[model samples]
Target chain A: MTASMQSSVGNPADEKLGMNLTLRIWRQKDPSVKGKMVTYKVTDISPDMSFLEMLDVLNEQLIMQGDDPVAFDHDCREGICGMCGLMINGQAHGPQQTTTCQLHMRSFKDGDSIDIEPWRASPFPVIKDLAVDRRAFDRIIQAGGYISVPTGTAPEAHATPVPKADADAAFDAATCIGCGACVAACPNASSMLFTAAKVTHLGLLPQGQPERDDRVVNMVAQQDREGFGGCTNIGECSAACPKGISMETISRLNHDLLGALRAGARPKS
Target chain B: MKKAVMAVSGIVMVLYLIAHMIGNLKVYTGRDSFNHYSEWIRTIGAPALPEQTALTIIRVVLLAAVVAHFWAAVSLWRQARRARPERYVTKKAVAQSYASRTMRWGGVIVLLFIVYHILDLTMGVVNPEGHDASPYDRLVASFSNPFITAFYVISLLLLGMHLRHGIWSATQTLGQSNRRRERTVNAFAIVFSTILIAGFLIVPFSVLFGLVD
Candidate 1:
């Protein structure tokens, strides 16, 4: 058996190596309630605990004391779901590329006082503490992101023989998990990153060719309609992206949008 | 004529700067060459269109371009504004470079400075107080003012930034999107803006520092 396993098996004292920590969490009854950071002290935190798991431990203690449990959103715990998001010390998703769930306590030191709060943006209204309604992203996607692929027909994956380069680019775009980190990380709360990813995803594929022009047109229009900011090509979105989505996608998005504008001007000649 | 209008105007502005730089290069040849060069251009109307009508037409065309460039910029800005109502806010300056972030403000300041420039030099209106001399002498005296020299420096810096974006953007606007050409244009934009800023600043500073006198 390994040393840790063997120690736990051999002596009970070995299991007592835990850290004491404090958390200042945002406590809001609802979106309407003015929230404040309420401090909670916890002892005996497992060094191996994921940050979310640590929160779970504190919530378990609160419930036993008949106090209202702190509410936060999380799922998948693998960083793929993108459900977990929080600003730990002013960073989107708290000092990590992906999400809150994947962040472990070990990334922090013992006795560290962590400040956790919800993503602050006007459009992303807080549903409950730490869980803003990200449906603006859904609406952006619904506005014409998909190819008009007919239902109930699974094509042979290899039938189209997509050029390797285009396919890879499309796959890179497809990795966007609809996390609002880009929007949160942006100074202007710009949705350019998310919208561009969706547009580029469709724009890169041959199957997406039929409605490519229309897709760029409507999606860009929708993104603007949804109150996102114009991209100044500052490159913050790509830098904060967990998947490292390139700012080149935004460049491509700009080209496509500009092309769409030209097409609008040209008429059915 | 819309695309051609922008293209022709943009190229004219670019060529004017090149010719302006060559004229300004006369500073290296001392006050005599510099003033004589200015006098020669005014007399012979170098780079201006056919004969005496050339100077008048050049002025008209230059003014038209100023209007067109500003009009296009305003229209595009309005469209972009209507497109996204919310602005960005950040505790830190994010991934944006200083030049990229300051474009709008820089453009506006330079625009205001251009007005001052026209009034001072072109129209001979709103002349600075206590600086009466020949146009050339006025130019020298104005450059002698630390305040005037400072404004010239600051505005020229902003002008450099504005041109860095404007030159590259105008190229993209013209649909020269080839990768090689885009990179070339981008580099050219940087060099062109830098040279223009340097050329313009040198004259004022030279006169200020007694090099011209």
Candidate 2:
């Protein structure tokens, strides 16, 4: 087993191999409370521990010291869940392309001091610390991010006859985990990449065609209504995306929107 | 739809800049050629259409494009501001260029310069020297003033920066960019903007230095 596993169980033997690090975490009692970065020094942290696990140790220390632990969000410890997100060192999802849970302590040196904060967009207000309301994304999706069909049929998967290219592109677009990292990393806090990912994913498939026109128009309108900034195509969204969703999806979204406009289709209010 | 309008109008402006640059270079060909070219612009549709008819048509189309472009820009700027009401306490800008970062300010400077340009040259209201002279003489008189020359140089530089970002962004907005072609598109934007700026600047500099007099 790794040193992290041993240290988790309170084994003294692996203590010598751990590293000391400092964390500057944001702390806010609630949305109305003024937040500040509270620094804490963590000793004997295992290099193999995930970033969240390191936070867990810090929380334990804070609890033992009769202090309020820093609040954060996490569900699946794995990267796919999209529940965990942090602006580690001013980057969305830390310095790595992976999510917070997947970021290991080894990415940092023993003497490193890390800064952690929540997503800072207006649409996403911080609830406490490191957790913002990303429901604006949900609202955008609900606007028209899905394909509509009659329920209750397990159709044969091969019947659709999707081209390999389109299937692959759709899958790539579908990889968006609804994380707000794209918004957090963007200078304008634009959610075009995230919105485009949803639009392109469904727009690429045969099942997505019927709703395609309305889908782009409605979803884009919803995105704007949510107060997410217009995309300048600066390309930070793709860079900050944990799944590496391409900016091409945004281009595709624009293409679809133009086509919809040319066809005289207006988004449903 | 706003982005589409911005991209289309922006491209139209870029094309106009290129054609205008090429036309201005004729100043080096002597007063007869330069004045002839300037007169030709107004007489393009003569006989079939009235004098200055073609130029009026061009001006109207360009005015409509400029209005659309400016409106879209302002709306997008306001929308972006609303997107993030609370700014980040500590922020890091990744994957953004200096040109991209300064686009708004650069656009403002370019807009101001366009107004100054129209006043000084087209209307002859702001020209330091004689306003009743021929087109070629007015061009010479304006650039001979150091302050006017400096203003033109500064404005052209800002315009070049704006174009550098504008061209690449227009392509992306129009869905012309991809992973492989991104670098090519960026390089093309740089080269194209540089050449356009240089072509335009040469006229004012030549007049300032007495090369074209």
Candidate 3:
């Protein structure tokens, strides 16, 4: 077996090698309440376990001890959902580009101290411990992220032939799972990457061309309205993004925005 | 829209800086050649369009670019400030460069330098030779003072820092940059800014050391 697989908790030999980690996590009762770092210790963590699973083990221990367990947002336990995120040791979604759920315990060594915090943007106010409000993203999407589709009948798959290059580009932008890591990592807390990804995902296709002008115009307007910081083109967002979304996506959004404005496009009220 | 405005205006300013540097380099040829070029600029549109008309137009365009660039920068900066009222307790730099992060403050210093520069050279108000002397004589006199030379050199260095990030960001803002050419675009900025700033600095340094006279 691979070394990591052999280190699973069921194996008695791995128990001696199990890591004891120190976690300093942010804890808040509610949005109005003040938050602070609260430290906890987890013992005998299997190298094969994920980061979130370590937290799970901590919470299970807490429940057994009749103490309030730390609250966090998570689902799927897999990377694709984009539902889980944590500022692990000052990095978005931990030290790796993958989501917190995908980061295994083996990524760290025994006796390591990890600091976990929620997304820090004002637009993403802390909800509890590691969860923050990201509904602002939904509003930006509602503003113009959708294409106008005819609801009467389903369009044929090959009805419109998309170029090989554009289809790939669209798919690349489409991979953004609305995770708040981009905002967390950005110095200005700009949502440029998220909005740009959505804008370019649709902006690249032929079907997307119809609303391309309005899409860029309104989505950007909504982005500004949400009080998210403007993009300084510092590239922290793309760097911290788990999907590996390219900076070109934001560039494409800028190009579309300029063209839209020159064409006298206005955001819908 | 604002990003485009900043990008376009920044390009206009950089293009003018390149031309300005090349024109300033005429000092090495001889005082007569340098002064002659300055005089030639005043009469650029002499017969048909009238003297100083082209120069005035160029000045007006540069002024417009500066105003537009400043306006966009301020609005975006204010929005950015409002967006993140709070900050992370432990935020670390991942991919951002020191030059990129220093753009805002560095741009302000560069702007101050431009004002001082125009007063000393273009207006001759701060030059020892004043408005009555030849352009070459004024330059030589101005750089002869160690303080004047120091300020000029410092300002040019700051301007170079601003341009390094400014030019690179302009490409990204204009959608000319991509993942594959990230290094290429960045190196282009570093190389162009270094050369342009070096060209300008050499003229002043030469004058300070008595090479231009």
* Top-TM-score structure, candidate number: 2
Model 3 docking grade = medium
The residue-by-residue lDDT of candidate 1 on B1-213, one tens digit each, is 133344456677767767766676676776566667656655574455444455576688778887776665565456445533333222334466566667667867877998987677655565553334445655766777888789879998987887776666455444444334656876888998898889888888888788885
- Tens digits of per-residue lDDT for model 3 on B1-213? 788889999999999999999998888899899989998998997888788998999999999999999999888888878887766677788989888787888888888888988888899998899978888888999999999999988888888888888887888888777767878988989999999999999998997787877
- Models 1 onward score TM values of 0.77, 0.92, 0.91
DockQ comparison, 2 vs 3, better candidate: 3
Model 1 agreement with the true structure over A59-81: per-residue lDDT tens digits:
99999999999888888989898
* Local accuracy of candidate 3 as per-residue lDDT tens digits, A28-128: 88999888998999999988898899999999999999988988889888788888999999999888788999999888989999998898887788888
DockQ scores for all the models shown? 0.20, 0.58, 0.65
Per-residue lDDT of A216-242 in model 2, one digit per residue for the tens? Answer: 989989988888888988888898899
- lDDT string for model 2 (B94-189, tens) is 788888888888888899999999888887888766568788988999998889999999999989988898998898888777666888989999
Name the DockQ score for candidate 2. Answer: 0.58
Q: Which one wins by TM-score: 1 or 2?
A: 2
- Specify the poorest-scoring 10-residue window by lDDT in model 1 chain A: A260-269
How many collisions per candidate?
Answer: 2, 0, 0
Off by over 4 Å in 1: A1-22, A42-47, A265-269, B1-23, B29-94, B104-108, B124-135, B161-193
